[model samples]
Target: MSGADIANVCNEAALIAARHNEESVKLHDFEQAIERVIAGLEKKNKLLSPEEKKVVAYHEAGHAICGWYLEHADPLLKVSIVPRGQGALGYAQYLPPDIFLYTTKKLMDRMTMALGGRVSEELHFSSVTSGF
Candidate 1:
């Protein structure tokens, strides 16, 4: 990793250890630090009604479920609804292969994966959120 990346991860690890009142950081702390730095901290103060929380949960679940069934979409790593990066309410993390070229089917699979969230909202709630 680059210098800045190392610094951020170390700082986050320290924060994680401190949060747990531990004297040393662990592997999972570093892992969580990377996620925290990438996704920003969870919106602790953001108040969502029970229904809204359910929607966000289902929205994230939809992405995972749809991507899981797709043949050519990137392999999903994680999904969350902690509201990271500007207006992002949630996200799906995919592990795309390192390549410079793409096939048409791969592109379409990506499209289907991307649309999964919106489709899920429409199907479940009979309406889509403005965020999707």
Candidate 2:
């Protein structure tokens, strides 16, 4: 994780511990904190048009489906469409491996998953946009 990510997780873990009247952050606190940090605080107040919502939903679903079936890809944990941290309209969470080196198949699977959204848009809408 990056320095900002570590800081955010620590801060969130601390808050979680305090909320439950605990003395220190536990494993569960860190897990929840990581999820919160990655998924980001939901933009409850953000508004979207129905058409935009449909498009985003489909795009995110495409990513999830692609990751699910791609054998060499990282294990998918979650997917979300809530806008967060500036212009991030959506994201896909994966249980990444620790090692740095990657095999050719792994890279290919990653590429396939990355392109899933655009493929989906083309298949469904017959045209694509750069919003993703």
Candidate 3:
């Protein structure tokens, strides 16, 4: 995250805590702020068919699984199938490693991890959707 992003997250977290009538910011507040920053706002009103939900679950899981297995991939943080942003069916979050420079192998691992979702869809459904 950038310096500005960190400031925004802290500010947002405080707001969330205030909304909940808490005297001080807590882990939950920061978590929500991080999610809001990373995933945009959650669109609770966005509707998905049962099939779509199922597909999204698998697709996100694919990303999580790939990251889990890749030595150079960032550590997986959380995976969600909730509809968020304009058209994201789901997302898999990762906690990027603290490194000043990345090796070529590291970059390749990241690419492989990113493609896991599309490959997963092909494997599971025998076809790929637009995938948001």
Task: List runs of model 1 lying over 4 Å from the truth.
Answer: 1-3
Candidate lDDT (C-alpha), each: 0.84, 0.83, 0.91
Local accuracy of candidate 3 as per-residue lDDT tens digits, 65-126: 99999999999989989888878979999888789899999999999999999888999996
lDDT of 2 by residue, 1-132 (tens): 999989989999999999999998999999878877877676766787887777777887888899999999999988878776556677788889897999999999999998888787777786776754
Q: TM-score for every candidate vs. truth?
A: 0.85, 0.77, 0.91
Best by lDDT, which number? 3
Q: What lDDT score is found at residue 37 in candidate 3?
A: 88
Off by over 4 Å in 3: none
How many backbone clashes can be found in candidate 1?
0
What tens-digit string does per-residue lDDT give for candidate 1 at 9-115? 99999999999999899998998998887777777777778888789888888889988998988899999877776667788888888887999999998888888
Winning candidate number (TM-score): 3
